[model samples]
Target chain A: MNVLLDNLSLFREGFIGTLELTGASALVAMVLGVIIAGFRVSPVPPLRIFGALWVTLLRNTPLTLLFLVAFFVVPKVLFPDLDSFLLAVCACGFYTSAFVAEAVRSGINTVPLGQAEAARSIGMTFTQTMSLVVLPQATRTVVPPLSSIFIALTKNTAIAGAFNNVDLFNVSKTLSNDGYDIAVIFLWITLAYLIVTYAINGLFRLLEHRLEVAR
Target chain B: MAEVSVTKDAAPAADELVALKNVNKHFGALHVLQDIDLTIAAGEVVVVIGPSGSGKSTLCRAINRLETVESGTITIDGKPLPQEGKELARLRADVGMVFQSFNLFAHKTVLENVMLGQVKVRKVEKAAAAQKARALLDRVGVGTQADKYPAQLSGGQQQRVAIARALAMDPKVMLFDEPTSALDPEMINEVLEVMQQLARDGMTMIVVTHEMGFARSAANRVVFMADGRIVEQATPDEFFNNPRSDRAKDFLSKILHH
Candidate 1:
């Protein structure tokens, strides 16, 4: 308790960092995920192949390896000035995007073919059909799955703690090294993750209820 | 599958609004449409009737180029329908389609469903589009349900809303693909009534339906198809009263007797 009280600021900053990482990665994942999902469903053959390869490669690779590649090789070749923290965010985001794309693609499948056909019959282009008609309906069914993916993403950010990203897990490890009881520190960090994940769950629950289809 | 011309009914002399020449479509091994030659004059209501698997729906779908034809030319308002891209989309805007399932956007309210094509495709301003959508809903007799989502409405109400959505585009031709077949028996007449009103309003329409009553009452001509071939074409009175081909007589006997 004394150690925890002494490290209150550490906890707060660490938690804030975690939140920032989660938020940034989530935003990146969302945009990339939607684009990849579009490619999966696109009429063009090459795009479908690219989408499939993206999902398979990213989803199969370990997150630790992605983090290492992003931190080491990617910075050297692509972004020499990129911070390790930004690299961590990109690594986690790109990995999570594969899951997000799959969830969104499955959500799109849940919408009947008639909906798209109806939109097309009314003269809407393929993009308009997807954006205005299909995506809205797809969103209603995807909240739960998307929440699950984001929750996983939030937890996965702890893996970045190894590279001194200063998230909750890293803070706990550093404090434990400074003579604080490791079990208690771990317990508190666990609670911190629970709080963030629960917040994500609640946010998605609210969205699900708010955006549910009329049925 | 042989083409049979049972009626010598002279083609209407008005401007040809939709013309199909030697249209052929195949689904893998199944020859779904075989050399379909049809012409629709302005303000004409042509009802296509046949048993299941007879390609009547395919014939109607072909008009809007919804189903790609293997070999054919389809022209609307003196312009050929392109297979894809912006030209096809433009052609589609001039043709409205109402499906049997209503197919109203479930996520959208009835009013939004009616307004979307106008706003997005036609680029109509929102305020004007909304107003026109409301007027169309009212015309279809579902104005009061404009704010409700499609799932909240009954089948008849939903179909009416779909018609309103199609009409909001001010399409030159409206295609109805078994619009009333999916409705409940009691709800069928309400939708038929709306369609009857559209016919009276001189909307160029191609209807694929099982409703012989609608055919006899509203259609200028009835086309009978069997096994991917048009077996007969005649005025409704002549077609129903004295079907010429044996296939038409057999189809009529099965449907009308049942």
Candidate 2:
């Protein structure tokens, strides 16, 4: 208990770092995911192929391998002075985007072709139809899957702690190793992750309810 | 009987509202519309009836370029439908279509569904468009359901909303593709009533339906198609009383006897 109280500041700092990393990486991942998903569904053959290739390659490879490449290999080969934190965030974000893209693509496909045809018949251009008619419907259908992806992303951020980044997991590890109450430290870490994931999932549920009501 | 005058102000001549010359269409080695030639006069109600897969629906769709013709020319109100772009949009704006499934935007209220094309395509002001949309809904006897979403309505009510949506466009010509086919037998009359009212008001319409009663009562001419070709054309009374083609007689027997 005494050790935990002493290391309270360390826990706070680690939590803040974890929050920042997750926030930035999740944003990056979501944007990339939507773009890739759009490309995957595009009528243009080349763009569709490229999008398919991206998701296939990233999803098939292990995230740890991607992280190593982003941090150790790519930077040394290209820009030697790239920041470690940025590299970690990029690697995690890009790795997660592949899964997110597949989820969004499936969501888009679930929207019936009639919706698009109706839009066209009424003189809306393809973009207007997609943005107004299709995407909103697709987004509603994809909410649960998207929430799951977000939760996975949050947990995966802890992997960055392996690279000397003082994320929540690393902070707990160091404190517990340094004669802190090992069980308490680990319990706190678990609770923190649970709280974060639970809040995200709760938010998704609220959004889903709102969509249902709107419908 | 309502005394409805067909609009004469800037209206084209009798042969001009819609004309198809030597139109041919196919579905990959299966010819759909073969050497079809037809004309729709202003304020005329033409009903197309045919055996299944007879290209009746395809022909109706072709008028708005929903289904392309392989060879031939289609002109709307003396303006030939261009092969691409803005001309097609302009042409389509003058035409309206209602489907068998009552393809109302499921997410939108009846009023919004009616107002969408007016605001988006015609670029009408919201306040005026809403007023027009309301009037259209009232015309279709669905004004009270304007605030309701499509999913909340019965099949009959939904089809009425679709009619209102098309009417809000102020289209010169309307196409109905088996509009009452998806309705319950009891619900069919409600939709047919609305269509009968439209015909009484002298809307130039091309209807593809199996409802012989509507064709007989409201249509000026009935076109019968068979095996992807128009086998016969006649007045509804003549077609029903004395069908020239054996195929038409057989189709009428099957449809009417059951």
Output the number of the DockQ-best candidate.
Answer: 1
iRMSD per model?
A: 1.2, 2.2
Q: State the lDDT of candidate 2 residue by residue for B145-240, as single tens digits.
A: 999989999999999998888888888999999999999999899999999999989899999998989999999878888877778778787788
Candidate 1: pairs in clash: none
lDDT of 1 at B47: 93
Positional deviation of residue A83's Cα in model 1 after best superposition, in angstroms: 1.6
| Every model's DockQ | 0.62, 0.30
- Tell me the tens digit of each residue's lDDT in model 1 across A15-102: 9989999999999999999989989997678989999999999999999999889888987898899887898889999999999999
> Best by lDDT, which number?
1
Native contacts present in candidate 2, fraction? 0.25
RMSD of each: 2.2, 5.4
What clash count does candidate 2 reach? 0
lDDT of each: 0.90, 0.84
Q: Candidate 1, residues B1-258: lDDT per residue as tens digits?
A: 544454324346468899989989899998989988988888989999999999999988888877889898999998988866677887898899999999999888899999999999999999999999988888889999988989899999999999989998899999999999899999999999999999998999999999999999999888888888887888899889898788888888888886
